[model samples]
Target chain A: MNSFTPDRTSFEARLHKIGDERYHDKHPFHHLLHSGGCTPDQVRAWVINRYYYQSRIPMKDAAFLSRVTDPALRRSWRRRIEDHDGTEDGTGGIHRWLRLAEGVGLDPDYVSSARGVLPATRFAVDAYVRFVRDEPMLPAVASSLTELFAPKIHKDRIAGLLEHYEFANSDTISYFQHRLSEAPKDVAFGLEWVLDHAVTKADQDAAANALIFKTEVLWAQLDALYSAYVSPARIPPGAWQPGEGLLQ
Target chain B: MNSFTPDRTSFEARLHKIGDERYHDKHPFHHLLHSGGCTPDQVRAWVINRYYYQSRIPMKDAAFLSRVTDPALRRSWRRRIEDHDGTEDGTGGIHRWLRLAEGVGLDPDYVSSARGVLPATRFAVDAYVRFVRDEPMLPAVASSLTELFAPKIHKDRIAGLLEHYEFANSDTISYFQHRLSEAPKDVAFGLEWVLDHAVTKADQDAAANALIFKTEVLWAQLDALYSAYVSPARIPPGAWQPGEGLLQ
Candidate 1:
C-alpha cells in the first residue's frame, strides 16, 4: 500500500476521478431519461423512485449534524436540512421534487407517501444515510463529495429535460435549478474539509472509497430502475407499477 | 394527540404488537425458507445476503458505543461488539456467520468480502446502523427492542434449518444458538431502559416507532430477497446470483 499522501491538487484529482468514473450521471438510465428516450411511464417511475432519494437527503444531513460537535460545522450543515426541508412552508428540494412528480403527471401525495417506490431505491438511499451516520468523520464527509459532481448533472438534466420532455419547465425542474446554485457551495466546503482532514494515505484511500460508495448508492438506484422498468421489465413486487399513480 | 403515556404493561404490549404485526419471521419468504421450501440456491442467496447484516452488527454497536458517554452504558454496550467481533481471532458472531456461509457451501472469503450481497440487504442493514448511531438516545435504544423478538426467531430458525437443510448442524447453527442466550440479556436491559426513559407520551411513541422502523428494516430485506429470488424474480442489478458465489 502506498504510504505517501498526495498533495492537495493530486488529492482533488483523485476525488474527481472517482466521480468521473463512478457517479450515477453515467448510469444508462440517466442517459435514457435525459435524452428523450424514456416513455412517460418510465419518467413517472423515475420521479417516484427518485423521490425516495430526495426526501432522505435532509434526514441524512440531520443525522450527520447530530453527530457533529463543532459548532461551525453544525451551523454550516444545518443549511442543508433547511435547503431540502424548506424554511417555513413546505418549500424545499423535497417539495420541488414533489412538483416534478406533479409535472410528470404523478400525484404529489402518492409521490410523497413513498409507498410506491422500488425496494431497491429505498435500500440504496437508506444506505447513503447510514454511511453518513456511521462512517468515521473523514469518510463520512468524503461521501458528500458526490456533490462535487452534482452541478454538472443538474445542469445537463435541466437542459436535457427541457429540450426533450414536455413536462420539463422552470417550475417543475426548479429542484435541479435550485440545486445548481446550492450544490457547489456544499461541495466546495466538503471537498476542502475532506482534503484537509485526510492527511494520511489510508485516510485518503478511505475518502476516495467513500465517494465511490456514494456513487454506488446512486448508481445502484438507477440500476434498480433500469432493471425493473427498462427492457424485459421485471418490476419488483409492490414497487410502483407504471400507470398506477398517475395524476388525474 | 394522546398526552398520557401508557403504563409499562401497555407499553410492553404495544412493543410486542409491533413485532407480531411486522417481524420478518412472519414474512412469506421466512415461511418458505424455514419450512424447507427453498431450493439450495435460494438458501445460498439468503446466506450471502444475511451475512451483510450479521457482519455489520459490531460496527453498528461500536457506532452506538462511540456516541455513548456513560461508562455503565458503554460497559453494557461494549459486550455487543465483543459478542459479534470477538475479543480475539477465530471468534465472534461474524466469524460464526461465515462458518454458516461455509456450511451452506459458500466461499467464506466471498461471504466476508460482501461483494455479492443484495444491495437491498446492505441498505436495510445500514439503515439500522444509522438509526442506532444518530437517533436520539431513547429511540436509538428502543430500536434494539427488536431483540426482544429475536430469540423466538432464532429458536425457529435453528429447529427449521436442522429439520430441513442438510447443511444444518450443531456447529453451523451455533451463531443463532449463541444469540438465543445473548439477545435476551441485551433486550431485557434495552426494554427496561426504554421503559424507564420514555417518560413522556411522545417519547413512548417515538420509541415504539423506532422499534417499528427496525422491524421494517428486517422485513424489507426479506422482501427484497423474496422479490428477487422467488416468483417472477427481478433481482436488482448486480445482486448475488445463485450458482455464482458458492464454494467450489
Candidate 2:
C-alpha cells in the first residue's frame, strides 16, 4: 500500500481540483441554461428535475445528522436541515425551490410532489442521501464540499436567468441568494472538519473521492435533463413531458 | 382516521397489482433482451449493469440481518446472504452472475469491480441497500416482497435466454435457475410475516407502498438501461461503453 501522505495544503488542493474538473457547472446543459439557449419548456424541465435534488438535500443532511454521535457535530449539522426545511411553514430552501418552480410556470404542488421528476434525477439524488447515511463521517463530510463550488454557479444562474427570462426576479431567485450565504458557512466548517480529520493519505483520498462522487451525482442529473429535454429528445417512459404539470 | 382495512386476500391482490403494473418484466428492454432484439453490446451492458444489482443483494440481506433480533427470522434471512455470497469462494449468486458476465464476454473482474456500471444503476441498487438498512423492520421486510413475483420472471428469462442467445447455456443461466427455487422459499416467509404483522389499515398501506417502492427500484434500473443504450443513446459521461471492459 502506498503511504505518501500529503500536508494540509496539498490535500485541500486535491479536493478543490476535483471540483475544478468534475463540477456540474461545466456541464453543457448548464452552458445552455446560463447562456440563454434553453427554451421555456427546457427551463421548466430543469426546474422540475432539479427540484428532486433540492428536496433531498435536507433528507441527506438529516441522514448524516442521524449518524453523528458527537453532539458538536450534530449541532453543526442540524443547521443544514434547518436551512433547507426552515423553522416554520413556507420558509427555507425547499419552499423557495417550489417558488422557483412556480415562477418557471410549473405547479408548486407538482414540483413538491416530485411525481414528474426523471428517474435518473431521483436515483442520483437518492444516492447522495444514501451516501451520507452509509459512508464514514470523514468522507460524508467531504462530499458536502460541493457547496464550496456552489456560490459561483448560483451567481451565474441568477445573472443569466434574470437577463434571459421574464419570470426571473429577486423573489423567484431567493433560494439561490439564500444559498450563497448559507453554503459558504456550511462548506467552511465542513472543509475544515475534513482537513482536520483526514490526516492520513488514505483518508485524504477517500475524502477526495467522496467529493468526486458528489459531483458525479450532480452532473448526472443535468445529463439526464439535457438528454430528455434537448436534441434527439428520447425521454424515457414516464418522465415529465413538455406540457405536463404546468401552472395555468 | 379512516379504518378501511383490506383483509389478507385483498392485500395480497393489491401487492400483485403493483407487480402487474410496475415490474421490470413489463419493461420493453426486458422484452428486447428476452426476445434477442438486443445487440451483443447491449446484452453486455445489461450483464455489466445487472451484475452490480446481483453483487449487492447479499449486502442488502446482510444489512437486514444485522437489525434482526429474532433468531428464527435471522436464521431464515441468513440463508439469503449465504445463497448470494456462497459458503466459499467460486460459488454463490454473485459468482454465478460473474459467470454470466464472462459468458457475455465481459471481464469478471471488471463486472465485479463495478467500475463501469451506470450511475443510475449504482444509485438504484444503493437505494435498495439503504432502504433495507434504515427503514422499520416491517417495511424493510415488506420491500423484499418483490421476490414474490420473481420466480416466473426467472423461469421466463432462463427459457428465453436459452432459446435466444448463444451464450445462454446452463452454466451462464444457472443464477436464474437457482433463484427460481430460492426466491419462492424466501418470499413465502416474507409474505407470511408481512401478512401476519401488518394488521391495521395504516400498516397494510405502508406495506403495500413498500412493495410499490421495490417495484419502482426494479423498474427504474431497466428505464436507465433503455434510455442510455437504446433509443437516442445518450450514454452518460462515465458509464460503461461497448467494448470498453470486455475480456480477450
Candidate 3:
C-alpha cells in the first residue's frame, strides 16, 4: 500500500471516529428526548417530524434497491424495504413508528399523512433519498454505514423512554427495539461492502465523506427540530403547531 | 364558479399574500444582509451557499424542460437555462455571481465548485429541483412562482449592497440587476400560467400550497444560514467555514 492509504483496521477506525464525533446521538435534541426533558409539545414535534424520516426509509431503500444491479446485493437490500414496509400494511418499522406516534397522542393517520413535517426535516430526508438514488454505489453504500452507530442510539432511546415517559411501552418503543437488532445485521454487510470496496485512498475518502454526509443528514434533522421547537422555538411557517395533529 | 374556487384576481391576491407572509424577504438573515449588519464572514458565507443555488438553476431548468412535452413551453423555459448558463462557460448570471464572490474576496473557482455549501442549502435547493422534476406540472410550475416576489427583493438587494458593502459594485451587483428585468418577464408568464390553469378549488389550493412550499424552501435556506452562522451559530459539519475558501 502507498503511504497515503491506511490499512483496513485504520480505515475502520476512521469511520467509527466519525460516528463518535458526529452522529445524531451526539445531538442535543436526542439528549433531551432520551432523558425525558422534552415537554409533551416537544415530544409531539419530535414524533411528527420524525415520522417524515420514518416514512421515507422504505422509499430511500427502494431507491437504493432500484439502482442495485447485483442479485445478491438486491436480495440483501430488499430486506431493508420489507423491514420498514412489512409483509402486510399493519406491520413493519414504519407502522411501529406510527404506534409510537399514537402512543404519544398523535393521530396515526395524520402522522402517516406527513401533513405537518418541518420543511427542514423533509429537505434533510429527501436529500438522503436522492443521495442514495443518484450517488455512485460506493458512497451510497458507505452512507448506510451510519447504521453502525444506530444500535447504541436505539438502546439509549428505548431505555430512556421507558424509564421517563408514561407513553413509553413495549409497543411504542418497539421500533427502536427492532432497530437494535436490525441495524447491526445491516451495518455488518454494509461495512463489509464498503471496507472491501474502498481499497484505494480515494475510495476510502469518498466512503468517509459519505458517512459524514449521512451524519449531517441525521444531525440536521435534530437541529431543525431543536431550532424550531426547542430553545428559541421559532417554528417556521406551515409546520405543525402544538395541538394541531393530536388524536381526535 | 363554485364558491370554493377563488376568482383569478383573488387567486393572484392569495399568491401575493403567501409572499407577503412567508417569503424570505422577511427572514432576519436578509434584513441583516441587506442592512449591512453582516460581518465580512457572513457575506462570504452567504456568497458560498447562495452559489450552490445559482449553480443548480440551469440543471433545474433542464430537468423541468426535459419533462415539458409542449414545444412552446420548452421554448419559453429554455431562456432560464440560457440566462444562467450562457452560451459558453463564464458568461452568464452564474459567472456574474462568481464576480460577486470575487468581489467579496472569495475564490470564484471555489464558489463555482460548490464544495463549501451548507447541507441545508443543498437539501433545500435539491428539493426544489426534485419538486420541479417530479411533481405534477402545476405544482412544479407553481413552485417557481416565488419569482413573482423576486423583483422587489432583487431591487432591495441591489440598493442595499451598493449602499453598504465595500465589495458592492456594478460588476458584483450585476446578477441582481439582471434579475431586475429577467424575473419580471419570467414571473409574468408563470403567474398567468398558474392563474389560467388552476380552475378548480383543489387546483387553486394545490398551487397555493406549492407556492407556500416554495417560500418555505427559500426561507429554510436562510434559516439554516442563520442557525448555523447567526443565532445559535452552530455551523453544521461539512458546511463552509469562514476562512477556508478565500482568494489568495
Candidate 4:
C-alpha cells in the first residue's frame, strides 16, 4: 500500500462521509417530498424523474456486469439487475415504482414510456450508465456505494410518504419498502468489494470520487425537479407539464 | 423512396422547422444571455458551464470521425476537430472561449480544468459525445444539424455581448465571431449530408429526432445554468459556485 493510503477503517469512514455530506437525502427536493410540503404535481414530477433513475439502475448494473471478468463478481452484480427489472415484467423495483406513479395520479404507461422525463434527468441517469460502461471497474464499483446511503433514505421515504400523502399506501410505496431490504443486502457486498479493492491511495481517491459522482447524479435529478416543478418553476420545453400524463 | 418520403425541398424544410421550434436559441436563458441581462456571476456561471460544452466539441467530432468508414467523410469531418482544438495551443474555438472566460474575470486555467462544471452540463455534453460514438452514422450526422441554427445565435450573441456587456470585445468574443463564418461552412456540409442520406420516412424521422435530441443537449445546458444561477437559483452541490475560479 502507498504511504497516503488510509487504513481500511478510515477509508470506509471517508466513503460514508461523502454520503453524509453529499447524498440526495440532503437535497431540499427530498425535504419537501418527505415533509408533505410537495404539491401533488411535485410528487408526480418526482415519480416521473425518479422512475428514470430507477429504470436505469439495472442497465448500469448490467453494464458493470458485462465488464466483470470474474464469475463471482458477475454473479453478485447480476442480482442488482434482477432487483430492478425483476424475473418478469410487472414486478421488480421499476414496476413497483410505476405503482407509486399510479398512486400519485400519473399514468403508469406514460411514466413507463419516459416521454416526459426532463433532459437533465435523462442526461444524469444516462451518465451513470456510461460511467459504469466505460470507467475502470474500481471506480465503477465504488459508484454503487451510494447504495451505502440508500437504506436510510428508503426508510425515511417509506415513513414520510405513509404519514404525509394519501398516495402513500403499502402498494404505492412498495418500491421503497422493497429497497429497504434490497439496498442493505446489496450495499454490504458493494462496500466490502470497494474497501477490499481500493488498496492504493489513488484507488481510494478514485473510489471516493466515483461515489461523489453518484451523489451528484442523484442530487442533479432533484435539482432539475426542483427547478422545473417546485419553485420559480421554469419547465424546460418537452418535459412533463402539469396536467399531462394523468391517469384518467 | 418510400411512399412517405418527402421531396428534398420539403425534407430540408422539416429539418429547419425543428430548429425554428426546438433550438436552444429559443430558450429563455439565451434570451437573457444575448440581451446582457445576466449578472456578472451569471455570466461567469455561463462561462464555466458553457466551457464544458465547447471543450467537448472536438471529442464529439473525433468520436464521430472514429466511426466513419469512408475516407471522404473522415476527411470532411477532420476540419471540426481542427476548428475546436486548433493546430496548436492558444488557438482554436476553445481557446477563444477561454479568452471570453478571462474577459469575464474567470481564470482561464480554471475554466479549462472543468472542475466546477454542473453535473447536468457534464452529462449533457458527454451525452453528445456518446451519441456520436454509439449511434448509427445517419442520426449521428443528423445530430450536428443544430449547427444550422448556430449562425443566427452567434450573430445575435456577438451583437448582444457588444451592446450589453463590458467584457465583450473583438478578442473576447472571437469564438462567436469565428463561428459566424465557421458554422455556416460546417452546417452547409452537415445539412447536405443529412438531407442526402435521410431518404426514407423512417430515416427522416430518426434524423429529425436526432436533431431534436441535439437541441435538447444544447438547451439542457442552459436549463442547468438557469436553474443554478437564474431565478430561484439552487446550485447543485458540486457545481461552480459564484465566487470560485475568479482571476486575480
- Which digits, one per residue and each the tens of the lDDT, describe model 1 over residues B36-80? 899988988888889888777665665665455333465566567
- Interface C-alpha root-mean-square deviation, candidates in order: 15.6, 16.8, 16.8, 18.0
- All models: lDDT? 0.83, 0.84, 0.85, 0.85
Steric clash count of candidate 2: 0
Q: Weakest 10 consecutive residues, lDDT, candidate 2 chain B? A: B66-75
Q: List DockQ, one per candidate, in order.
A: 0.01, 0.01, 0.01, 0.01
Q: Model 4, which residues run further than 4 Å from truth?
A: B1-248
Query: Fraction of true contacts reproduced, model 2?
Result: 0.00
- Tens digit per residue, CA lDDT, model 3, A1-248: 68889999999999999999999998999999999899999999999999888777766665665454332365566567657766554777888998999999999888877888999999999899889878999999999999998888888998899999999999998999999888998999999999899989999999999999999999999999999999799999999999897898
- Chain A superposition TM-score, candidate 3: 0.98
Screening candidate 3 with a backbone cut-off below 3 angstroms (N, C-alpha, C), the clashing residue pairs are none
Predicted complex 1: DockQ: 0.01
Supply the TM-score for candidate 2.
0.54
lDDT of 3 by residue, B30-120 (tens): 9999999999999999999988888777666656654553334655665675577564545678889989999999998788778878899
Q: After superposing candidate 1, which stretches have Cα over 4 Å from the reference?
A: A1-3, B1-248
Candidate 1 Cα deviation (angstroms), residue A248: 2.9
The fnat score for candidate 3 comes to 0.00
